[model samples]
Target: MLEGVFMSFGAIAASYFTLAGGGGSSQYANAVLADNPLAFYQFDETSGTTMADSSGNGNDGIYSAGVTVGSYAITTGPGRSAGFSNDIGGTTDYRATVPYGSWMNTNELTVAFTCFLEPMGYFRLLASRYGEPGTDWSWFVYGASGTLRFHWRSSGGTNTNIDTGFTPVRGTKYYVAAYVNASESGIRVYDATGLVGQATGAGGTVNSSSRPLTLMNAATGNYTANGHLDDVVVLGSALSTARLDTLAGIALTPQPKWINRTAGVSARNGTTSHAVSFIPTSAGSLLVAVISTPAASSAVTAGWTKRVAAHGTYTECAVYTRSASAGDATIQLSVSISNVPLHYTVYEFPVGSSWHSSVSVMDDNVYPVLTGLPGSSPVTVFACVSDRRLLADTAGESVAWRYFWRTELSQETLYGGGTDGIFTGIGVIDEVYDTAVDVDAMDSHVETNGSGSPNRVVFAINVA
Candidate 1:
C-alpha cells in the first residue's frame, strides 16, 4: 500500500431482566446465569412492586410509586418486552432496592442491565452502594454527558475506571454489562455489541452490609435514572468474554487495542535527530510508524518496513511497521536526514493484529475524514504540517479517544522556512464499532501559526 495502509481510520439500571412479552423469562437460561450470579432479579411482575430473584437465591426488590411496572419497550431480545419507566419527576423519583447481603465480593464481580436512556441533563444513577468515597461502588451514566462511568475500588482510592468508548442515546435500546476480575487485572465491558471495552481491573467491594442495592436511583438521593430500565444482573464473579457476549445478544470478535505511542522532538535537516524509545507493549504486540518528510532519506531505523505513504510535491508521509517478539525488549528509533523527513512516531497495536485499512494524502486537508473502517478495530490519525507553530487536536473527540503527543518543531526552516508541528493518536475503538455512528475526522491544527499557510501530510490507520 503506497499512500494508505493502516490508517485510518450505559448504564443502566439496577439488576433486572425481562424477556420480551410474557414468555420472555425463558431467555435467562443463557450461559450468563450459569455462572451462578449472586442474585438474579427477573422483573416479570406487571403488578405490585416486587421484582423477584430467580437465581434460586431469592433476593427480591421493591419499587417506588414513580416506577410504572408494566411499561413497554423493544429490546435486542425477542418480543416486545415489559419495562420499568421512571417518570423523571412525575410523583416521586424512581427507586428500587434489594436487600444487601454477603453477596458483596470485592475480588471479582459483574453487573449487567438494559435501559432506555432519556435526554435529561443530570446524573442518571444506575446501580449504587456508595456511602463513603473510598469504599463506594457507583455505576451510572452522567445524564448531562451520557458517559457510562464505573467506580470500583479495593478500599481508599487504589482503583480506576473502565470506559466504553462509545456513547449511548435516546433512540436505541442497549444491553450493558461490566465484569471486574481483579485476579486477571481485567475489567471487560459490553454494550449492545459484545465486549466493547476493557481496562486493567479493580477489585469488587464489600458493602457496609447495611445499604440496600439501589436500582435506578441512589439512596442518598443525589442522582436518579431518567429513563426506562428493562434488564439488570449482578454476579459475584466476573463473566467470561464469551458469556458476556452472549448476554449482550451480539456476536463480536474482540478487536486489538492501541497499547502505546512515541514521537520524537523537533530537528533541523543538518542539525538534530531523536532517539525515540518504547518497550514491547505485550507478549506479541506489533510496532508501527508514520514518517513525514520532504523527500526520502536514510533517516529510518533498520528492521522496519514502509507499509504506506503519500509523496506530496513539497512533503510526504509514510507508514512503517514491524513485529515485536514476546517479552520486555525495547525497540529504538535513531535517524539522520538532509532536508525533510520532518518527523516520525512509533506505536504498538494489540498482539496478533495487522494493518486493515487507511486514508492519506501529501497535501493540505482542511476537512479530512477516515472512512472504510473495519467494524471492530481502532483507528489513529497522524499529521505533520509545514508550519511548526502547530496545535494538533481531534475534530470529534470523546471519552474513548486518546491523544498520544503534540510536539512543536521550533528549529526547522525546511521547504518554506517554516516551523513545524505533529500530533498523532488512537482509541480503544476496537469495539464492534457502528461506523455510521462514530466519526473519524482529522484536523491538522486549530489555528495557523502567525507566519504561514503551510501544506501538510495527514493519514489515518486501522488495526484489526
Candidate 2:
C-alpha cells in the first residue's frame, strides 16, 4: 500500500511527441507550436535567400542579398537559432518578404523578433510594410532616440503611433514585438522584460500592406537593422503581454528526433538487464519499463523503483520507473537467472507528465477503479497488457477491453491453452492504447472467460 493521488493503467510516447521538422528538437518547437502561429521563420539557411517557415503553414520568406546568413549556429537562447549578420548597406535594398495572403489581412496581427545588433548609429527598422503613402505600418528603433515604436496606417488613411518607451541598444540581444488590432487599442510594443508601451489609437493591421510583409526594413531598404534575428514569427491574432512572452528568446536546434521512428514505440525482448537502448534528452522525463520474464523473477535497475509486481504462469512481471537524468542512454537491469526469456516494453511518458499510479494484474483486473481524483483538471490515462492468458471474470469487475491495440508478440499463453500451464488458457490476445480516449470511458477491469487461465503483465500511467 503506497500513498499517492490518482490511479493509472498505462504510459505511452513516441512520434506523438515529435516536434517541428527534424532540423530542430521539438523541445522549443513544441512551445511555439502551442501558439499556432501562421508562419515561423527560424532563419536556418546558409546561401539561398529562402527562409523556411517551420510553422508548417508554408508561408516561407525570401531574404535580400544584403543579408548574410548561415545554417543554424547560435545556441545561447531557447533552442537552436540560426545566426547571421545583416549588412544592409545603409540603403532600402535589403529585407525579408513573406506572403500576405488573404488570410493575413486580419484585424488582429502580431510580429515579433529576437535579435542581436551591432551598433549601426542610424535608424533600424525591425518589421513593417510598404504600399500607398496613406497605407503603411512600420516598427523600428528610430535613430538617436533608440526608442522602440509601433505604428500603423489604417486602410482609412489614418496614422497612429504607439511609442513603446523602451529603447533598444546596440551590442545587445533583445526580444522585440509589436501588436496591432482594430478591435483593441492602438498598438502594443514589447521587449523581453514585458509590455513597455501601448496606446488606444492604432486601428489597422496587415490589411494595409500591398506588398509582402517585410522584416529588417519596410519591405524596401529603409531603416534596415544590422543584426542577427531569430524566432521571427507572425500571428493571426493579437496576444496579451503574458501570452506574447512565449516568443522571447526561443531557440531552434536541428538534431535527430528524440526517439527515432522505426523502433521507439514497440516492445523488445532480451535475456539481460541491459535490454533497452534509449537516449533521453532532458531531465524530468519519465522512463518506464514493463518486464515479464518467463518463470523467473526480474529485478529493477539501481535507479528505478518497482511500481507493480505480479505473477502469471509462475512468470515474474513488474513495472520499473525512473525520472530522466543527465545521461541515461541504455537502461540495464538483472534477473535471478540469465538464460530465461525476458520480454519488456520501454515507454517514455509524454514530456511534462506526472505519474499517477501503475498496476499489474494477478487476477481479472487490468486497471483500478479510478475515483476521488484530486485535481480539477483532467489527466491522460494510458495502459498496455498482454492478455494471452487472463483468468476468468469471476471477480465481477470484469468488463470487455475497449481501448487496446494488439501486439505481434505472444508473451502470455493462458494456462488453459494446453501448454506448460498452471490454469486453463483462454486465447492469444494482445492489447494496448497509443492514443487517448475519454478518461471516464475506461473500464475498471477486463474479462477473458469464466474459469479461464489468467496471467499477464499490465501497467498504466496517469498524467496530470
Candidate 3:
C-alpha cells in the first residue's frame, strides 16, 4: 500500500488551475498564458466595436470607421479575426489604436501575430506607432512582394529597416515576429512547414514616441491593411530566437480548458511512496500527467498507481517509459529497475466528458494502457504525482519532479535542455514542457546521463 502522501494547493480565482510555487508567474508561463502583454488581441469576440485586450494590460483598442470582425480564415477555434479593407472615399476603413503609456517606452520590444494577406499594389501596415514623418515605428508587409518589414526612425533621422528576404505567398497564413533592441533589430517569418526567412539589422537607437500604437492602419490612414489578423501580441522586451520559434510553431487557437500541477519527493533510503492529487473543478476534463525522477533515487521498480477516489479503480492512458539499461524489470502498470532514476508521463482523455480514476508508479520504464477520450475534443483537466525510493548508497540525496496538463490543440511547440542530471527546480529555468504533445510522440528530444546520478525534469504548460 502507498504511504506518506502529502498534498498542497495554490488557488487562483481564474477558472484555470496552476502549479504550486507560483508557476503561473514565470516568463515561460506568461508566454503560455499570453498574459501581461503590453497589448494582446485574440480577435475571438463575436461582435464588438471595442477590441478587448486579453493580456489584462488595459491597453484596449477601439475600432474605427467600417472595420469589422469576421470569421478566422484558418482556425475557427479562435473564432474570429479583425478584417481590414481599403476605402477609396477617404474613410479610414478598419483600424485600432491603444492609448500611449510608459510601458510603450521600452528600448526593446517584440511584435508577433498571424495574418492572411490579400494581393494589393502597395505597402500594408500590420501594426504601427506614428510620429511626425521622420520619427515612426511600424511593422508592415510589402503588398506586392509579401516581404515582412519593420521600420523605426528617430526625429534626428537615425533609422533602421529590418526585413525578411523571402516573400510569403498571397492568401496563405503566416506567422511573423519582429524583435527590436536598443542598437539592433530582426524579423522572423514562418509558415506551416517551419521558418521561412530571418534577417537582422544593427545600428540606431529604438526611438520612443508619445504616439498611440495603431493596428491595421497608420494614424493618417495612408497604408491600410488588406488582410485578416489574429492572435496579435505586443511585448515590452525583445524575445530570443528560440522563444520566437516556439511562438511560431504552436497552434494559434486559445485553449478553452486547461490546468497545471507539480509535486516533489525527497530521497529516502528504502522503498517510499509520494503522490499529488488534483481535483478538477470541472467534471470530465482530459488529464495529462508527467513525472520526473532525479538520479539520486534508487532505480524505480513500477510501484505506482492513480485513483480517482481513495479506493477507486485505475484508469488507462498512453504511457511511455524509458530506462538506462536493457535489464530493468517490469511490473503491472509500472516498470522496475535498479540504481537508475526515471521519468514518467501519461496522457488521459475523458470519457464522453466525464473523468475517471487514475494511479501511477515510480519505475524506470512504463507501458501505460492507452485508453481514454479521443483527441478530437478538448481536455477538461488532469492530476499528476511522483513516487520513488532512494538508492541505499544514495540515501539523503534529493529527488524532485513536476508535471502539468492542457486541453487538446494546446500543445507546446518548442523545448530545450537534455537529461544530463541537471535538475532545475520548477520555474527556475526558462525551458518547460507543459503541453500534452511533449509526451504523446516524445516530440522533444531527451538526452540520457551515462552516470548513475539522478536525471530529472518537470514539464508544465501555461494556458491562456
The per-prediction CA RMSD against the true structure, in angstroms, equals: 14.6, 20.8, 15.7
Instruction: Please provide, for model 3 over 1-464, each residue's C-alpha lDDT reduced to its tens digit, 9 standing for 90 to 100.
Output: 11111111000111111101111122323554553567776654434666667677777776664543432122322221121211111135556767777777676778887765555445666677863464455333333355677776643456677767666655345677887776668888876557788889873445777777777667766676555555668887788878787766663322222232223322222322433333433334344444444333222234333322110111111222221122322222221222222333333223232332233332323212223422222222332322222222222322221121122211111111221111211111112222222232321122222123222222222222
Off by over 4 Å in 3: 1-36, 73-91, 131-144, 154-156, 252-350, 353-464
**Candidate 1 residue-wise lDDT, 242-313, digit = tens:** 666665653111112356765553445453354445667676677876565444332445666766555533
Tens digits of lDDT, candidate 2, 200-229 = 544554344556677766654556555555
* Model 2 CA lDDT for position 200: 51
The lDDT of model 1 is 0.47
Worst 10 residues of 3 by lDDT: 9-18
Rank list by TM-score: 3, 2, 1
Q: Report the alpha-carbon TM-score of model 1 versus the true structure.
A: 0.44
Task: Score each candidate by Cα lDDT.
Answer: 0.47, 0.47, 0.42
Candidate with maximal TM-score? 3
